[model samples]
Target: MSNKILIVDEDSKIRKVARVYLEKEGYDVLSAENGVRALKEVCESEISLILIDVKIFTMNWIEACLKIRKNNVIPIIFMFNEIENINAVQVLPSVMGDYIKKPFNSEELIEIVKLRIKRYKISPSYQKLDKINIEIGSLTINRDTRQVFIANNTVRLTQKEFDILELLASNKGIVFSIEKIYEKIWGDVFFESDNTVMVHIRKIREKIEEEPENPRYIRTVWGVGYRI
Candidate 1:
């Protein structure tokens, strides 16, 4: 199937220009005037990536991204007119793939789009799962859907967070160190000083655990690692 990219922007000229450039590279382009329209489009269609404007008038870009992330993990790129000191940080890494400043170079835009989509495709979470739920008390993790729920209410987790949770939950009794967790989830070399896994674990606890200070589900193994 051809890769389809959704561009959400209020400016008709910007959409038209993006479509022209993207179509030349054989990417099917879809355009939405606002975040509401973008949300509707995402639900109705299968999109590989999204290019959204930072200055959305009808709806907030972060809100739009969170809504999309409810069911889809499609890569999202934010567009900015100019960098006003670390503008990219405004777009959350969990919901955002990357950002390109307005009046962006066609090569840069295309490269960013290509890289984000590629990364999403190769991500372990994007691959096939058993379509089963692993239950741990009130928490329910659906592997296939990549969703977490407490009782009946859904809990939002970043892709990495979910992956880490699922890894421990699936194994149940196994203990995975921070290095192992990082290497397994990230598929990369783990630096001795890196606290990436620890940080994500803390974030996951904040969202899922009632009292992050004294967590109930995920238990720290003191000097070793964490377990569910």
Candidate 2:
């Protein structure tokens, strides 16, 4: 998978901060101080995702985004300081994948970068699941469509929830530590304070388990992690 991220911003500080954190997380980080350089980088290299500031010094940021999206569906995330500025560039959600406010936390920036890159990596046409259908007790997991069904009824799950469940279901009977699960899904370093995975597990159990306290499909190995 291409783990390249192109960061476009006028401020050198922004680029430096992003490059430092992203490279530390194992991404091939590239940066541009202006739109011309940014476009040239995209044309010359395989960029997995883009993080662009809505405000740029050399060119209109919105026009830059439009030009980039003209031929590529690579994920693009907007960065801006003010909420009003974000609203100004409210183009089709299809063109813009996500946004992050400036002065963002290092952890939050890393998390978003990992998520966007991970989603881009798992293209339906390119990536294949180990198993298409996973059955555990009354639960049914459809890997192709990323859906879960229980007793012939659909169990809706958030993207993260589905990811955690799919990971466990496909590799049934193998206990995965919290660090492993977080790294596999988030594509970034895992910290103990990051309860994002834990929360998603709880939510998945609530939707799929008859008793979340004592999950049937997803069994928690005490002080270890979880398994199916």
Candidate 3:
């Protein structure tokens, strides 16, 4: 299946250019000029990735990214006019998947898209399971139906959250720096703040950990990074 992508930017010229290039690469593209339309498209369509402008029609990309993280795991790449305003290490803990300074090379953008899709394929969380049952302590992850159960109660997780959990679980004892984790999960070796990863981890912990303040599965590595 051709991967579908959603592009959100207020500038029609930018959208047209992006659409042209992406279409030439054989991707089915959808676009929105505002956050409202973007949200609608995301909720109503089967989009694999999203390329969003950081500033779009009264919508803050960070907040939009966070909202998107609440429901979908689709890789989100933020395009900004200035790289200096973004904190690559600190923001990695939030909803940032990748960061592209404006005036991005068309070829580079395509490569990034391909890389993100490739990484998503190998993600432990997105792995298909033959069985419906799997256990993680009191939490049960249902691969067949895409559901997580804790103490017989269901815990809903966004696609990104599940992906992060799967990565950490797949390498239980291995420590992953925020940068490493961002690269692995986001397919972007160059990213914004590390906090983007931290924020997502916190969200995941809130859902699965008995106490997010003192997590059991996902652990912080002080000045380094995180581990499970």
Candidate 4:
């Protein structure tokens, strides 16, 4: 069955456009004009993923995401028109599976949705691990619980960061190009922007590394991409 995606945005135009594109891609699309209605839909229906606008009436996207996370582990992508320092530093990490900056290509958005769904669809058994425990230096990843620990301190990672780390760590010594990483994690190679990957990588490094400038687990390959 096709995955069901719930879109929550204040703009009718964005909702209409996203619905059209996602429907064409064989997804079951549903939409709401604000967080209140979106939360209602989430409670009432079976949704595999969510695309949320950070600014909305009744409740903001962060609040909506917190509410959703309280009850569900469904993947959520947060959309913003501009990336303010406060939003990037505080708001985005709290409530999103991924953040898509606005003026985005429709095709890229569709691909990201597909990638998130694909990740969700993968069963635990498909993961490459001797058991559920994954150790890299002082960092330990518990696959079953989706928890990460770094030298006795529990490192908090958003879902997307964890996925990126897992993908790199799983295939150690392999140089994953930006295009390859986008396709593997976000599900679309069409919108392989360096900034998008950079933001995610920076965030991940901040959480897991002692010094993000000189990282241990995830490392940059210069002209290539990232490796663990």
TM-score of each: 0.52, 0.51, 0.52, 0.49
> Between the candidate structures 1 and 3, which one is better when assessed by lDDT?
1
Candidates' RMSD to native: 15.8, 17.2, 18.1, 19.8
Residue pairs with clashing backbones, model 4: none
Number of colliding residue pairs in model 1: 0
**Number of the top-ranking candidate, with lDDT as the measure:** 1
- lDDT string for model 1 (63-174, tens) is 6677768666788788878777235445455664577887876898889989998888887655532236677887878876677877534688999999999999999988
State the displacement of the C-alpha of residue 4, model 2, in Å, after optimal TM-score superposition. Answer: 1.0
Model 3: per-residue Cα lDDT over 107-201, one tens digit each: 98899999997886676544542133455566566554566656555688998787787777667788988898888888887465447888899
Q: Sort every candidate by lDDT, greatest first.
A: 1, 2, 4, 3
lDDT of 2 by residue, 55-144 (tens): 752335556667767655578888899888766556555456688998987899989988887786676522433246576776777676
lDDT of each candidate versus the true structure: 0.80, 0.79, 0.75, 0.75
Identify the candidate with maximal TM-score.
1
lDDT of candidate 4 at residue 63, scale 0 to 100: 63
lDDT of 2 at 225: 96
Candidate with better lDDT, 1 vs 2: 1
Clashing pairs in 2: none
* Candidate 4 residue runs with Cα over 4 Å from true position: 57-61, 85-94, 123-228
Report the error of model 1 at residue 142, Å.
16
For model 2, state the Cα shift of residue 201 in Å: 54
